[model samples]
Target chain A: MLEFDNTERTNLGELGEFGLISYLTKAVEINEPSTLKGIGDDAAVLDFSNKKTLISTDLLLEGIHFDLRYVPLKHLGYKAVQVNLSDIYAMNGTASQITFSIGLSSKFPLEAVEEIYQGALIACKKYNVDLIGGDTSASVQGLVISVTSIGFADEDQIAYRSGAQEGDLLCVSGDLGAAYVGLQLLEREKNIFLENPNIQPDLEGKDYIVERQLKPEARRDIVELLAKIGIKPNAMIDVSDGLASEIIHICEASDKGCKLYEDKIPLDSMTYETAREFGIDPTVCALNGGEDYELLFTIPQADYDKIKGSMDITVIGHITQASEGCQMISKSGKVYPITAQGWNAFKD
Target chain B: MLEFDNTERTNLGELGEFGLISYLTKAVEINEPSTLKGIGDDAAVLDFSNKKTLISTDLLLEGIHFDLRYVPLKHLGYKAVQVNLSDIYAMNGTASQITFSIGLSSKFPLEAVEEIYQGALIACKKYNVDLIGGDTSASVQGLVISVTSIGFADEDQIAYRSGAQEGDLLCVSGDLGAAYVGLQLLEREKNIFLENPNIQPDLEGKDYIVERQLKPEARRDIVELLAKIGIKPNAMIDVSDGLASEIIHICEASDKGCKLYEDKIPLDSMTYETAREFGIDPTVCALNGGEDYELLFTIPQADYDKIKGSMDITVIGHITQASEGCQMISKSGKVYPITAQGWNAFKD
Candidate 1:
């Protein structure tokens, strides 16, 4: 759990909405050439010229999407931005700008909001994205964050989820299930701490999993690497709702089926061991666990040689005709239809 | 007040996130040629060719930014889009697309959400804007709505708040203060109904004022009319935060001062009569009541004749040197410094 200083409790009402907006955005610097106007305007102006503009948005609410008791304000802000940017990257576009809006109750101090903006600015700088515009409001209850990310790409270079064809190789980047296992560890420690405040969290040698949950990164490197290697995926999407759910999305959008090989799925040793300790199958976690911001795409067979021998990219499945249906081939030589057990916000 | 059918409660959880997304977006149609790709993709794609892109966003929360007790779901959705589009129009741009995100608790039925979307689609159709992309999630408490609007304009035709000259004419579109007075009428009726359930709302002959509060319209016509008259505003902003606050923003951003004549301020007959009944000054309602969504702009004095006969546009004041400061000249020829009493979301 993160520690916050309660001594500095400055009420948000003192600044008012306009004063608070000015104070919070004073540190914002515009670096994107497309951004002609940033904050302190009725609207932000951009010049995308001939490139196709990509837009996506997400809304995250407290208690539903996160728990303030365990999640730090800075990490929450960083992760919120990363998740939105992941959508743009999934379209094979270069994210260049974002608009962030937040609604928080008066219970939060000025310093707490500052921390959130600090973390957001850090991520924006690292990714070379401009913080162009946003809206701020007071909520009646807990915190709320809404982000809209904007990106650009040449029309011919953009990849859509419906562009996949039969006989395409399904590829995934890095490993999965780490973020979900990390959450399980955090929840366990939270329960223990609630039962007895004196017992510290036993998170020794668990840094990798914990970090995965706290600060998941978007796969910008994968997009950049593909451009350098001259390989354009036929279809692409980010693994936000677990590998199984995202793969299903690709198949349905493209009107095709897929055969996912269970043995070929990449899993980090720590994620596997942690899931085992929690009495959960690692493969189930990999297939159903969400929040792993990895990239998943399909490449044509002719371009397979271009991505072969890459350590980060692994071929986990192959697309098939619609008649075959989407299936998962287990290591035991048994085939089962793939169903999405992805996280649903409405579920209790 | 609005009535909802409680007998048609369809649990939102029955349809998972993906299923819900598909069901909600099935009606979305792409009408803009610029929109290469719309819903069903990771991100919406648009090509604006050579025009500068304009973007703005707004966050609306229940019980704070709005009180759902008297707001109809349909009206709320319509007003949300208008308010965000007002920002783009304030920049003298033509709004083309929007991305809307919402969060609601499980207590809401699927039909309730459909009503909101119905209102949003109506607004989109009327404004000639496309609903490109969005995200929906279950909230832990009351409803939340966030909208991001996108538009386009030539670089030279765009108006920035910092471009006002010292001697520009201060002009405003349409009358103000009705929306504020309308809210008072609704609150009075709501209190009476809470104390005595059978008491009917006495809103007879008050349709004009009430509609102003529930369904405000953005001044897109003013932007187009200006282009037709061959007059470009030196600086412009929308009156979302009342007349006084918006003018103050213009003066501050341009590093100049303004003299607003109280006698020239536009006030509707219904708004004036209603404020008198409520035992409040009508001028205060116009100066600081907010939510007008009218356009406030400044143009060179040489173009005054071009707009003199237009009934909708009212010339209220003129820009002054920085040493003059922002002041209001009352009808009695008394001068007073203008202070911003605009609506603050953080205020209780």
Candidate 2:
């Protein structure tokens, strides 16, 4: 319903509330099986006959969660959805639908908001999740995006962070540290651009790291793959706050301790080399780098045989007695206590 | 756990993310039957058995949705949950749980955050809904609250906007214009307070309207009353954006026309006198002013006999053929086309 002219700036108010909502969601295709009713309702409705429903929410503020000067609106939108969906996948649930709300300042035009919607729709399509009802309002400050993702899983298939047994094998999906290194790259470029707008970012051969920071995907496939192999994780969580922080969550919740192998923590070659160039330890980057959006879960020792050779899975540690405490043993055979200094929600 | 003292400004950083979440929800007591899990996991788990689940999300920005100068943090938290619950009640469903996410600025001490949490927990307890999982992050700007309410209803009991027939009676619960008038009172007092701090708000007996503005309740009672009286609404919506706007939403969605009787519109004596005192039209206030949180629904005329003497429920309009158009007939017998210039989402 909103008509945005490519040649000039178009005010958001010119399109109004109904016009903007319709324009943003016009391309949203609802293919999720449980989505009985989507947009254009007081509340979206779903029918998940017998499965346990899972709900997760995330709020991404403009300046705090992301810097729009370096982060494109499209990437911000897509990453917001991925952030919430990753939570559901961490629960071993299928990411089914998302309701995305954005408060935009008048500083942005209709086209700018549309860019975010396009990216969000792309993530919804890629993850096979439907974009349900959400809201858009005029903000007094910069833009803010809030996404609530809904999913479901069979009662037995569902995983929790409080279920890890002493002998469960901790595993992580994909690599870590890349997203943090990529964020560092972007921040450097942003500073450079502010000093001189004509200088483009020197991001050659950094496509993988840049993509990790800009468009991280949720491990919905890993959730499905685990179920396909008939393995229910004893404990599970998404790798949003690095390997150490996430394991601390599982350990504290399950009332157990863990010994993570520092050498086994997954790190890409680019992440290692880039961290070295920046004078940061690659191991530290992997241990505490947030926003990877990968799945970190634990499977029973008996089920380890089933996923031993899985391509994206890496067994990093094993749960231990509570008295031992959560620690990481370095490749040099030195043990260190694991603490959650990775990402502090309270401290920017 | 984070401790809050009146004299000390406890930085949120003092208690890390896990500590903050644990401290805030330490008092949360879950009594909802559908809540299989709450707060600690990656996502909250729920089971709806054979019922259809409903979900609605709302983002309340600092300056956009509320003014902290006049709006107390406690009331802001309560009203945030109330707003989303109203959407569920409008759908003829019971709100069962809410996940409250807030991006709080460091300007707010840990005590201020706890006050918001206390108010939210109170709302959840009063509504018989569980406080499910949520996240608290640091914001560079002011506080932003995002509430996602989850509800459920039996297949046949759920109401939709597309069900109103030609002869359905449009009904509203409670009086209108009170909230808008109350807001006007607060704004006037705020201006006076800015001019001179010694003069306290002359709110005398205006407590009712002031409460309506600061703390609104969802029409859950109306939904319960209708079911108890064996009456189901043909179509329903919450009166958030004034009566005219809500009726227009119903008409546009149902593809029907409506004739609202101005004389039949319910208004409290205080609301009318207050609007007149401010040199504003009470009808205008009722028709265009927003944030009442009352339920507006259309019931088949056949069910009117059952609710003829219902408490708080007023039948103010009737549905008509699509060609008739949506109009309001004043007491003077003049018909005017209804418009929704109330509460524009894209405008301040």
Number of the top-ranking candidate, with TM-score as the measure: 1
Which pairs of residues clash in candidate 1, taking residues 3 or more apart in a chain or in different chains?
Answer: none
Compared with the true structure, all predictions reach lDDT values of 0.91, 0.89
Question: Interface RMSD for each candidate model?
Answer: 0.9, 1.4
TM-score of chain B of 2: 0.97
- Highest DockQ among the candidates is held by which one? 1
Model 1 CAPRI rating: high
Cα distance off (Å), candidate 2, residue B233: 0.4
How much lDDT does candidate 1 score? 0.91
Q: State the lDDT at A156 in candidate 1.
A: 93
Model 2 per-residue lDDT tens digits across residues A183-292 = 99999988888899888888999999999999999998898888899999999999888888899999999999999999999899999999999999998888888889
True contacts kept of each: 0.83, 0.78
Candidate 2 wrong stretches, greater than 4 Å: A1-6, B1-8
